[model samples]
Target: MALRKVLQQLENYKSEKPNRVFTMYLNTDLADQDQQGGEWKIHLKNGLNNFEHYLQKDGDSDEKRNFWAVKEKVENYMHEHQKDLKKSVVIFATGEGDIWFSERLQMPVQTAFHWEDQPVLDQLKSLNKQFPKTGIVLTQKEQIKLIDAELGAVNDTTLYELDLNTEDWKQHQGPHHADSNLGSGGVKSSKKDELAERFEENRSRWYKSIAPKIDQYAKNNNWDAIYLVGSSVEVDELERNMNKQVDDKINKNLLDHEEMKIIEEVM
Candidate 1:
């Protein structure tokens, strides 16, 4: 589900009396300086214990039972997903299973925990605004890659390769592999130079042909912004030809890089 839809649902949810919700945002980024020693584990344990202690001291028996139920489920979820954890994890769940929203995000988040009438969503809302749904267009030579991403995670990717025989763009489902032919030494230098010159001369027309497809894709995906990344000429041509507004452009040929790395560099 889209983050916006989840946020909407969460905004409308409120726990009834005795049924408090559990919300947690944990930062588990291994590369972060403070997380080098796996301190998040200690933090998670202490945080859960604090909540349990508070309920035990002041809350009714029903609330205490609810808290325990939520805690156990939360712990199980954390343990199951720990191996696949990224930079952060956000979860909003209730004891009765009325609401269970969990996500592993690539973006870093401040660790926090809450046991309250409603989900704690201030940080999540801020993240949605900061990292809105984005379309990243990466181009190099005859190859173009379109990345659909939100909150630093890639949701989908489409690769377009120019068919020399047909002089048309052929669409592929994902970022399968880099165009090895671009760097292969099998082709004669003169032929390669000739192809390069031809491509340079027809760059504008070529990009123009694919621009409408990209614009339609952005519209269909409801992208908040579009970023273009490639050589200066390629970026400029693609940006100029596209109907949608280009939010930013990076003059770097990152078509061969991993999707996460591309997100890091552009975002």
Candidate 2:
């Protein structure tokens, strides 16, 4: 299921009887010493276990058993979706049988938990509100990048011969060049035009190939908006050629000179 739907379900959850809800945010970046991914499940289990221990001491036996049941449901979920755990995860579980919600996020998030009223949704609301609410597309002759600005997630695809930046098209000098032969100018001029034509063809093909993918990605992920990053000419060409639906989502274009600077500008 999509992340938005899962979050919505949690936001909409309701029950006639009193419901116990626990929300957890896990930081899954193993590189961070304090936020150890390896121990995430362990820590979560410990939290639930500790709470269950207190329930055992004071609450009725049925309530304590129900908490244990909730813990089991959470454990089973983590076990089933081990591979989906990434930079961050938000989980919500209720005391009733097997009701839960979870989503993986690309951005780093603080580890936290809250026991709140029915339909505990503040955490998800805060998470959804964070950041640029933008998707970024970076294009060069050789590659295309689709980035989720809020989540810091990226998807990359190679452009075959589109890496024109590394190629030497200048050697073919355009018709305007002073040095040329009589026969349609020098063989060099013909070569230059041929190279230019090839570049244009490749650029056209690249746009055709990538535009649909970008539209589909945005539609599936439900990005709030999208930005293009590249030269004005390239960005303009893409904007012109892309589908109307895709074009409508373009927030703006950013100069693509430096990667880090572009990220800062978008953020």
Candidate 3:
């Protein structure tokens, strides 16, 4: 789901009586200086225990029961996704299951926990503003990758490959592995250098041909910003040809890297 829609739903929600919402933002990034010793584990345990202790001391029997139920669900979810956890995890859940939203994000988040009538969304809102909806274009010789992202998570990816036979661009949806020789047609090793030279000669024209396609995609997806990543020649050609304003450019060939790694570097 879109982050905006999720935030709207949380904004509209308000727990009644014994049913309160649980909001958690847990940082699981081991590379973080403060989390080198797995400090987040201790933080999570203490956060949940503090809530339980509070309800036990001041809440009625039904509220206490609701708190316990929510706590169990939260703990089970963390355990199940522990292996796949990314830099951070955010969740908003209710005891009765009216609201259940969980995301393991590639971006870092400050650890927080709350039990209240409404979901605590201040930090999440801040993240949304910081990241927004962005399109990252990774351009190489005969390949172009467009990544649609929001809130430091990939929503979708579109790959455009140059079809040498037809001299046209072919679009493929979702993640794809990079082809070292996209349209090589199994050229002999001896001729590889010649092929590279020819590609360089036509590089600018080829990139310009796809510029309109990228602009149209950005318009259709309502991208807040566009980034170009590749060699100086490749990115410069693409940025010059495209009508949309390029927000930034990175002089690195990241088309073959993992999506999360690309995001981490550029974002």
Candidate 4:
């Protein structure tokens, strides 16, 4: 995932330079689950406040003591940058009165934090696969749909659809081919073959043409992973013609299905 890549790179820098700071990781959903029932913001605020209070007191726990030293800066950072918090989880690394790392996640984590590496990293690693964002591309000969997938819901407005006039030869069986197969007309057979070839060429070109656009769209939307849903030929053509970076992110291939079902299955 893009977030993991960025975080890992930052972690490497931190390792070499060695900054003394505390990391605040908040899993809003998980925090809310601990509460009887309340808004995400309230749960998040309460969790952080409790931890901050605990850290400020003199304690035998080494982790708590470490957290105490940077409590002021960490609290200020979280308060100032609370708007960055989104669904799932958010990690904010703070020191020097500002956030060093802040990111919203598509996957949830436990609501907790530490002075250094947070437990969230371990959960992400355990998944063994990183998907900062997953997009579903449903394609056919004449139509295509790009859908963004989230934890529990699919954004219907994000569904991008493209329609084309390209026709399917299999569905358009003309008298030309029928008469030719009867051992009657050679010219009709030639025309039939030419038409069939042209149809295939046009269809293949259509798929190829859309590949780059799809790649661009994914990049613009920050989709780190994508699923292809369509006929094998169309999917293969798109994959073959896609930009290398985008092509590498393809995680699944599925036959086109109903929109809701696709979302449910993928999520």
The deviation in Å at residue 132 for candidate 2 is 6.9
Screening candidate 2 with a backbone cut-off below 3 angstroms (N, C-alpha, C), the clashing residue pairs are: 141-162, 142-162, 181-186
Compose the digit string of candidate 2's lDDT tens values, residues 1-267.
Answer: 344666667767665323567677777766678656487777776777777777767757656665666678777877887777777777777777546776676666777765545555665577667642456666554345555545443332212223344432221211121233223223465487775566576776657666776677666556676677666666776666666343222343432334445555665
Error of 4 at 62 (Å): 17
TM for candidate 1 is: 0.91
lDDT by residue for model 1 (1-267), tens:
488889999999987658999999999999999998888899899989998898888858888888888888889988999788899989898888898999999888999999999999999999999999999999997889999999999989998877665668888887678534433444576788887887898888888999999999999888998999999988988988999999999999899899999999999
For model 3, residues 1-267, the per-residue Cα lDDT tens digits are 488789988999997768989999999998899987878779889999999898889858888888888888888988898778778989998888888899988778999999898999998898888998899999887889999988778888999988766768889899898554556676688987886797799988888899999999998887888999999989999999999999999999999888978988999
lDDT of 4 by residue, 166-232 (tens): 3321222111112221222343655766645654677667666667767877777666567776667
How accurate locally, in lDDT, is each candidate? 0.88, 0.58, 0.88, 0.51
Task: Write down the worst ten-residue block by lDDT for model 4.
Answer: 168-177
Model 2 RMSD in angstroms: 10.0
Worst 10 residues of 2 by lDDT: 168-177
The parts of candidate 4 lying over 4 Å away from their true place are: 13-19, 30-36, 39-87, 117-120, 124-135, 143-201, 212-225, 231-233, 236-265
TM-scores for the candidates: 0.91, 0.59, 0.86, 0.51
Stronger candidate by lDDT (1 vs 4): 1
Clashing pairs in 3: none
Which of candidates 2 and 3 is the stronger one according to TM-score?
Answer: 3
Clashes of 3: 0
Q: Where is model 1 poorest over a 10-residue stretch in terms of lDDT?
A: 178-187
Error of 1 at 130 (Å): 2.1
Better lDDT candidate (2, 3): 3
- What TM value does model 3 have? 0.86
